[model samples]
Target: MIKPYTNKAWYLVLPVFALVAFSAIIPLMTVVNYSIQDIFDANTRYFVGTEWYREILNDTRLHDSLVRQFIFSGSVLLIEIPLGILVALMMPARGPGSVVCLLVLALPLLVPLNVVGTIWQIFGRADIGLFGWALNSLGINYNYAANPMDAWFTVLLMDVWHWTSLVALLCYSGLRAIPDAYYQAARIDRASNWAVFRFIQLPKLKNVLLIGVLLRFMDSFMIYTEPFVLTGGGPGNSTTFLSQTLTKMAVGQFDIGPAGAFSIIYFLIILLVSWLFYTAMTHNDGK
Candidate 1:
């Protein structure tokens, strides 16, 4: 007969559970409460049910921002994933050179998000910024302040510069973790570099690529600080993503109920998309 099981160790998790409840659950409940009520003042709050959600769902502003958000996040994933793989492949396998390359590549990730935005803001200025100056010198009319296309390009370029290293580093670690025996077998078989990489390394990198894609998608989808600091959602609202729009509604306009509703919808959208990404990436893994 099996002995009676004891799960005393589970008790140790109580503090963590309590902490999550206090930090996340309570705040989420508060948002839900606010979403369902229209507040006139501290003493006057009317129960409005799902009116706020309905309004938010129908808002054209939300539609535009959501579209822009998808485009930006999609572009980021498409560019960064393959570029990162290439960078990892080109990186030295081992030695002091590898250490130096890693440190250099990691430098951009060390910078604060706001600081990265500020750097790009100054760097893209048409007055004295190097990039702006060079473009003007080449007789190119490149003013991000007045051009929506320019602003979009600048923001996308900045994101690539800021976040590509993270993908590269993750891919590099995955490449290094691969066993030497696989490479030895390929070499013994006189396999071409393309054949070895395609048959051996590419297959092994699937999990790592999935992680990178998910992370980049999430981060790009929720991105705010960098673009806000750089563009201020200007050039005709071309770069105004969902987060910035929500911030404007909640903080700028002080629309508490609608903002709360917007936040919940945003959270649900992110949750759903992230689940889709995970499912699509892992669907074939079991086979």
Candidate 2:
């Protein structure tokens, strides 16, 4: 008789499932409940039947924030992805240099988000700040406090400086995982530097690059603390992203009903986009 396959091991997953339900599902249900109601006070709430959702969909403030959010996230991916690959390519694969490079790359990630923002805030000031003084010395006309473009550029540069290391570290790990035989084969074929990168390195780094892209996208999309501390969503809301908008609705304005709806929509959008990214990246793995 043939042996029957069994799945009794699934019982081991019960605790994890329970934890997820408690942490994620219960909070989600609370948000869902809040989204469909109007709250007058702690003691008064009335059902509004998707009014908040409709309001959010039609809100121009939300639309503008979404646009700014996408632009910031896109710019981060554009810069970090290529810059990471270049950094990884230049990294030593062996010896003390590799260890030192890894440590240096990790330094930015080690700093707390709020502190990073604070550092950049003081570092970019016009009078005492080195960057500001240098720019003024060069007659560059830079003022992050008054110019919208300067504010955007400062936030962008800060983000790039803070997070590019994450992408580089991920790419480095992926590159280091490749077998030496692959390099030997490329050498035997007399592959040009571009050909080796295009054919060998690029293909191998695909999964890691995908991971970097998704992680950076999600983090950048929800970014709040750093920009909030650095620019306070000024000069005139140039750096206000989705999370900042959500915070303004929920905490700043205390519009719980609409904030709940916004939260649900925000969660759904992130989930949908992450799924799309994952699917697109892994679609060709089977081939």
Q: Per-residue error at 253 for model 1, in Å?
A: 0.7
RMSD to the hidden true structure, all candidates? 2.2, 2.7
Report the C-alpha lDDT of model 2 over 1-287, residue by residue, as the tens digit.
99888887788998999999999999999999999999898799899999999999999999999999989989989999999999999999999999999999999999998998888888888898899878988999988888989888888888888999999999999999999998899999999889989999999999999999999999999999878997899988888999999999999999999999999999888888889989998997887
- TM-score of every candidate: 0.94, 0.94
Mind giving the per-residue lDDT tens digits that candidate 1 earns over 39-127? 99999989999999999999999999999999999999999999999999999999999999999999999999999888888888888
Model 2: lowest-lDDT 10 consecutive positions: 3-12
What TM-score does candidate 1 reach? 0.94
Q: Give the TM-score of candidate 2.
A: 0.94
